[model samples]
Target: MARVLSLVAAAGAATLAAAANPHAAMGGYQPATNVIEHSQIVYDIEAIQTALSADDFTEAKNIYMNGKYSCKSTSNMRNLQGFVKQATYDAKLNGTAFVDAFVDGDGPSYGPIPGSGGRLMLSPTFWDDFLLGALDGTGDFLGMSTAIRKVAINKGVLGVSTLYAAYEMESAIGKKYDDNSADASGAPHAWDEGWAFLYGSHPADDGKYSAWEFSKKRDLDFAYNSSAQAVEGATVATDMLLKYFLHGLRASRSGGVLADMVAARNNIYRMLALSSIRAALKYAEKAQNPYNEEYHMEAYVYFLVAANWVEQAYAGAGTNVLALLDFKKTEAQLSSNLYCAVKTELVPSYQPLGLDCAKVGVLKGHDDTLDDNCNAPACPATQTLPTGLDSYVPDVTTTVGS
Candidate 1:
């Protein structure tokens, strides 16, 4: 869901190729494994930045919306992508002025209200007519199939697999909202809120949807590293928790067969949480350079904390694997494999919007230094991993970037 432009284009083309054929996903061509590799990542980042800078707003906008939530039909990526392509291209063609006017500013634009999602406006490049290609091709327009099928229809393997990433984030946040509303102690709204709890994420708290909207309108000028990378992933492990609570606490209150739905939702949430935790941990661990161990160390600490939280999810529910699944470790010895953060950060520091209060490293008898590893005093950053973010370590004597 957070894939950059080149990835989206590549995915779009791939989806096109796949839809054209019966076996594109199964055997069309191997998708690039370097989806998240550093050079490729940095290059894509720079390319998009440069494109935006050159006021090649047309190409850039095409990249934004088409990439976020692509629409691949039964035939090709091109068929489904035109509407968004035009909408995005128009947004970029108008530049920031258009974005402000239509998206969030004072001109004629879509408001926060759901009914007014957005509209299709053609760019100078494709002004064949008013509604030829721009208005109808976009899946987000009216009645797109609300299913996982949409995700697969529009993405390359890497992009599609990560679709679940966005889904999980949105769903988790939705669960949080459900949790909030259900706690209101009113039976009607509480009953009204059951659909939200037992299903995937909702339209209201959808960060991806908002992000996609930002792109569609060209307000996507956000600095990637600065704003919303994997902030969705951060909550992946947390939201599965609502499932446990629902299964344990609200299952009785499910008003009959809704209880079964509760259990199924719980299972789905558990699978998503466990898989997301495992996948993100793999990605974070890959960031380790010789001397740098900051971002992922924080991630590890969170993983452990999430692991601990999962235990509470199943405290009295008898024996269950959902808790054990978080860290991919057995509950009988989760402590041994787990790492907890004793170090702390400012209470909500991940964004300019705010900082997050969190313990920062895994607590272990182990050391955070090369000396502890019986190596030199200062560990060296390698070509495989570039390590410079370790300057703010709380307890390590041999800190990098100090």
Candidate 2:
């Protein structure tokens, strides 16, 4: 079993580096002659944004749920559409109340999440509890509003973009980049797919001044707070990420051996994973107050998601890059320390407010809970709370006093 797991991880890493030149020795292949068109998802987001600006959220929500909008034209696959469908189904099953509560702003509030029909990937019930608790409207609306806004823009909008770009890359790599086919345009197409992930359909001809010009624009607007330092940090992070994507995209465009381009793509994916983890940690920092347990927990949800992505991306990297990032240490921090804490401390203690331990997210249907009990071996007898992520330490000593 361990050997199989190792092979699977190695295969995943190797595949990310698989966009090799098909006719490397033939000497007859021409340089890419075509420009990759803007993905259909780009226009879909434009329309969605228009609806949002017009306060037509009902229509916007419908468009999002149905996946009726245009997807990437580069590939016949409906990767964006599939993601929308899955997201909608998950939301309905686990986050109906959270989505609906924010949908109208004045509609029905948070309600019970339904039982798992298939199997839970992550628990919406636990997520909702943290979000509701964090955003109780007691301290201020900034934290709550920021959380919702980030969710809407990052998860809803840019999430589609990332999936679309990844799908295009998959198509090119799977086909081995044969320009003779409609789906494959060699390095140019593969590079463009990755470019679109960070920059969207935004024309590069225009001057790039602000970090907001890229996918991280809405991120800045939604993560608003009184602290100037926090905003500045987000800005810097967004810009750094943009620079990496842009450079990688250019490298991909410049005619080269497929190995180099593949490495560029892998590194870009690595940055994406890291940037997301940083964002989650920052959000977690904002949710540290005892009065804001909900937000604190919700931040971890994002953290876990980011950590999972990093695990996958890091598995794809070469030894040099792996050593530079110290990925094994990072993975231990995520899979061992943080994972154990979430399983033991965060989820169980919040149960009195109606969280169900049995429903906590298990890995691929395998329950790792201690003795298969949700509340047993309760948060170590010596420690008041889990250690390690002290930056996200929750104030468990006192109840919120209004």
Candidate 3:
């Protein structure tokens, strides 16, 4: 027990240290000045959101299907458009009724988010399918706002952008580069594309409406309050993620070895998984409160996203994580106990990714009394990696990106 506590303390210290000097990557890093051509996709997504707010489905559909954004040309964004178009169509037909169900009787509001705009939570299927289902009248409208803002825009657009970034990273790995121009062919262009998808038109410091905002939201969600021990915990995960991207780009530009690029890509993947886990934990806490359907859906969407990455991080434990984050569970079935189990299950998955599980802090604004059963023995203070994962290596290292 003493040794476990010490390990947890050390992990916290390491996370704080990384948080304090996130740019400690070899050679100082700067945001790339190249134009992120596809970044307008994020803007397009916001426009669609605004259109939906005004019950302007035709306008939303036009922006989604006919927008002049460069990202629309990308295969990934194009793939997402079909889904977004369907959602927008359903919204055009049913959104007014859905909005009427809300106490506010208006479209989703952006003011309540951690940052300035809507929350950009991601999911490949759970939220995606649910959003479509809700809009099509198969699912309840109780959480329809969450379905639109989080799933349709965030998952369908920004999340797909991040996935594209991941694709670019894979493309850049083990490849030779001639120059670092954004227009350059091969690895250089791929690296820039990765950066654009994640950072998108806005500077990193003031990033919005893209994967950057999602990362920031997770950072704020998991951040511990200021203390003598750590002043920068709030942005630790976000900073680390940015640092990884910058480092990876530098390696691509300078013709560095596959190992460096691989390290950066893996770290980015780790942070993605960590951020998803943090989000899941946060909404799980919120879901424990009675009478908030949105919170329940939020918890489920993030947990589903986290599960996808967790499966990648630890192949052997994939089934267990998926079971814990089951998409079939209804709002009433989501509980603190289930999330507590999730937290415990995920603890082991963090170590191999170089993340400190202990730093997955509890989100503020929740009543602790509500989650009393999740503490201590029920959830356990320490959990070991599932029996085989400690020895099982992830396939991500060996899979070549196309």
User: What lDDT tens digits, residue by residue, belong to model 3 across residues 248-306?
Assistant: 76556543555566566666766776777777667655655464555555555554443
Q: What number of backbone clashes does candidate 3 have, counting pairs of residues 3 or more apart or in separate chains?
A: 0
What are the models' TM-scores? 0.22, 0.41, 0.63
TM-score order of candidates, top first: 3, 2, 1
Candidate number that wins on lDDT, 1 or 3: 3
Clashes of each: 8, 4, 0
Q: In candidate 3, where is summed lDDT lowest over 10 consecutive residues?
A: 387-396
Off by over 4 Å in 3: 1-33, 57-62, 71-156, 177-183, 203-205, 224-235, 315-328, 375-402
The lDDT of each candidate is 0.25, 0.33, 0.47
Better of 1 and 2 by lDDT: 2
Q: Please identify model 1 stretches exceeding 4 Å from their true place.
A: 1-61, 66-257, 289-402
Per-residue lDDT over 1-402 for candidate 1, one digit per residue giving the tens place of the 0 to 100 score: 222433334434554421232111101111111112111222222333445456453543354334322222333222112322346345432332122212232222211111112221213322222112222334322332212122212211222122222222223233333443232232212321222212212123321221122121111111112343432212222233333323322322223233332343333333332332332233233323431233333233223312211222322111122232222222343322221111111111122111111111111222344123232122112211111111110111111110
Best by lDDT: 3
For TM-score, candidate 1 versus 2, the one ahead is 2
- lDDT (C-alpha) at residue 380 in model 3: 23
